[model samples]
Target: MRFSQILRFHLSNNKWTAKQQYVPKHNPVLEEDIKRLQDFLMSKSNIVVLTGAGISTESGIPDYRSEGVGLYARTNHKPIQHMEFVRFANVRQRYWARNFVGWPSFSATEPNHTHHAVARFEREGRIQSVVTQNVDRLHTKAGSKNVIELHGSGYVVKCLSCEYRIDRHEFQDILNSLNPEFRDAPDMIRPDGDVEIPADYVANFRIPPCPECNGHLKPEIVFFGDNVPKSRVEQIAKMIYNSDGLLVLGSSLLVFSGYRMVLQTKDLNLPVAIVNIGETRADHLADLKLSAKCGDVLPKLFNFKK
Candidate 1:
């Protein structure tokens, strides 16, 4: 089936029922607010968009912090703090194992309407740049030309000891050699990919060493407690600085890395618009809030002339 047909089917069949169910209730935006957002975008020669997991949820990826479906809530796991992963070998192994299993699902997800809308905005010259908290790379897949990944992507694995970088596929081979029994593990496995192997069995699991320097390997994403790379932060800041306004999609901005952009935009006195299903940490900071599904609202709001 064509992609459009698949989207229509999913929308009609209620594949995203959970998301719809959790949609927050907020006062409907007045027509004046809509006009303000529209005028802001129209007036700007350069607009910057900061997006979160909400944008990808329509594509079947779950947001990490959305009520009962959040990663920590659903997995019955605590958030992995950065210090723990860096200091503890077992923690690192567990992290990689979970990722190994979850990688396929994350990798398989495609761009949805919101992503396409952002791409359209860029193509139409309404948007000059995008900064995304999602590591899923949906924006790039949707043909966005310039995107800053605030949290690094899961598509690449880097060795800590030797500083070696390898494609996720190559890392999968290493995982296979170490845990052959888990090579075809079921999808029900943990979100990070580690199977429910007994603690005794875990001892025998041989995490592969870096091909270059025999060092530890880690996913490129910034885990809880890890700081965003300064250079990456600066790049996004510069993008925001140059743009006339900022648009936030699908994020609550609970994390400072995500929230700080709103503060920066406000500091620069730029108009800010947000499209989210729930109350975001930056809600008070926005000039306009569209309390609607990104999939439903973005396509309409950013309809570009082709």
Candidate 2:
């Protein structure tokens, strides 16, 4: 079927229900398909790998719209809008309060097999670079060098007013001092280091200001309704143009920023491969599609020790 003939690529409600009951039943891939991807990678020089949250799910981080397992499936709440976060003090407070509590556990998360596999590939000179949509920085932790963080990282705090940046781990100490009696009321953690704490719990929550100018502090990550910087986009496009092939791992390409890479590669007539459990926006454009968990499948495909 043509790209135009494909259905709009998002998870369906019936599929969500089935996933909840059965859990993680990815479509079985043909042996020839794996061989095709392996051969494709071996033939390419300066291969570019793009990744999304599915690569980090095995590391204990929940994805946003991943059928039954995602945060959107579990909750009716919408993600905090960029305008709301910048404009409203109360919104930021609620966000910070929940995020600060969630940060401890979320930060403790380590790189899984999926991350290691990518890193191993890079080390073996099979891949030139990786571009990730995730804020978790697991790719870096797994020892993948030359990674372009498409959405930036959540590990740093940025002052919206003064342009001051500080490590998120350091900012956590400040948060602890501000809300000593405040503990996380909800056990559920969201994809963006936020939790579902009670409204009452957030009412008196304190969001610390920037030390230099007493400005608002936000996680350095790009929020929904926010635009990725033009410079970053240009840089990523150049990298994609320079690459011989594009390999997408564990991303549905639901967001345009990550999806654009595949589109660019297609436009350039470069070979494209996508490894995702669910339907991706660029599925029709890919030369190969592997519907499997990145952690398990990637290790099987690319063993660095060999």
Q: Which of the numbered candidates is closest to the native, going by highest lDDT?
A: 2
Can you tell me which runs of candidate 1 are displaced by over 4 Å? 1-36, 190-203, 302-306
Candidate 2 residue pairs in clash (backbone atoms < 3 Å): none
TM-score for predicted model 1 compared with the true structure: 0.84
The backbone clash count of each candidate, in order, is: 8, 0
Give a tens-digit lDDT track for model 2, residues 1-306: 532122112113343332233224577666676777888888987999999988777666778888876778766657778899999999999888878877877687788777888888898898989999999989999899899999989899999899799999999988888887764332444333336677877898888788899999999888999999999999999998889989999889989999899889999999999888878999899898888777546776754432
CA error at residue 249 for candidate 1, angstroms: 0.5
By summed lDDT, which 10 consecutive residues of candidate 1 come out lowest?
186-195
TM per prediction: 0.84, 0.87
lDDT of 2 at 145: 89
Highest TM-score: give the candidate number: 2
